[model samples]
Target: MAARAMHVLTSRVGEHNAVILSQEALSNLVGCSERRLRDAVKLLAAENWIEIRRIGGRGTVNAYVINDRVAWAGARDGRRYSLFSATVIAVDDEQPDANELGQQAPLRQLPTMYPGEGQLPSGEGLDPPSQPSLGGLETDLPARRISPPAGSPFDDEK
Candidate 1:
């Protein structure tokens, strides 16, 4: 389950360490049964590694807040008190298949924005064009090197 939490860590968003995913989705991600997932949740909560804010229901999804001390990806100042504003919800990958009557066929093509509609606030024009050339963009620094600090035992200092 710790491994699963690490995987889900990538999906966390906002200033808070929170993720909104369904039990089924989590179970599938963890390669475990829902029962095992529940048990792991209990253990993690008992260890103060996570907190469950809300359980998913009809028209709702499970909400979880990981202990910032255990795993944090945002600024430290607002982690304790801030609520998640930017959330990325995780759902099952498999879409519902068509039944015998073929009433629920999976959609093949989704609609996309017409060229200029990608801009926010609706009225803004397209962004500036990319730079045409890199003539003046040369860097003076040498290729990056990975080495210990000069004073460290691994350093090449005499």
Candidate 2:
């Protein structure tokens, strides 16, 4: 569910490379309750996968930047942070208040996978994985080209 929410948010990082959306809308897009989304987002922010920039105040639209940890890590490694880099990035170490995070039990840590560590046959990252269908199921169906139907209503415009 967290990954799904991440995908929905990261996908919006199109040409601009950064996206801003309300938490409510983002939760709806990921098909999860806002509570679940908030918990998942806090975990992701802690792991440095995404950055939620504070806007007005609490419960507001914060700038969602993907691939932020990569940049922060690069800086620590003596490399300048470039928005054009293909590497994933991080954000500032600022976190929300503990009360906002709730008094949930500590989450178990998962093994980290760096570049060249876990390579798929197609060489893809795991966190922001590109799953086209259910549960990463790959289909062998031939690709189809989409085209508009024969003109009817808009034909008069020509």
Number of the top TM-score candidate: 1
State in Å the error of residue 9, model 2. 1.3
Estimate the overall C-alpha local distance difference test score of candidate 1: 0.59
Evaluate residue 59 in candidate 1 and report its C-alpha lDDT on the 0 to 100 scale.
22
lDDT scores of the candidates, listed in order: 0.59, 0.62
**Number of the top-ranking candidate, with lDDT as the measure:** 2
Kindly report which residue stretches of model 1 are placed more than 4 angstroms away from their true locations once superposed: 10-16, 55-60, 68-83, 92-158
Stretches of model 2 off by over 4 angstroms after superposition:
69-158
* lDDT per residue as tens, model 1, 1-158: 75575466445645756677777777777788878887877777777777665543552346667655333356677554335533546453534442333465687553445443432233346543344335786335557878888889888864
User: In candidate 2, what are the lDDT values of residues 1-158, reduced to their tens digit?
Assistant: 77987888777676654566667767777899988988888888888887766545685455666764324335646654434322222222223553555567789556454554343333344453434445556555667865545685545444
**Can you give the lDDT of residue 3 in candidate 1?**
56
How many residue pairs clash in model 1? 0
Error (Å) of candidate 1 at residue 14 is: 7.0
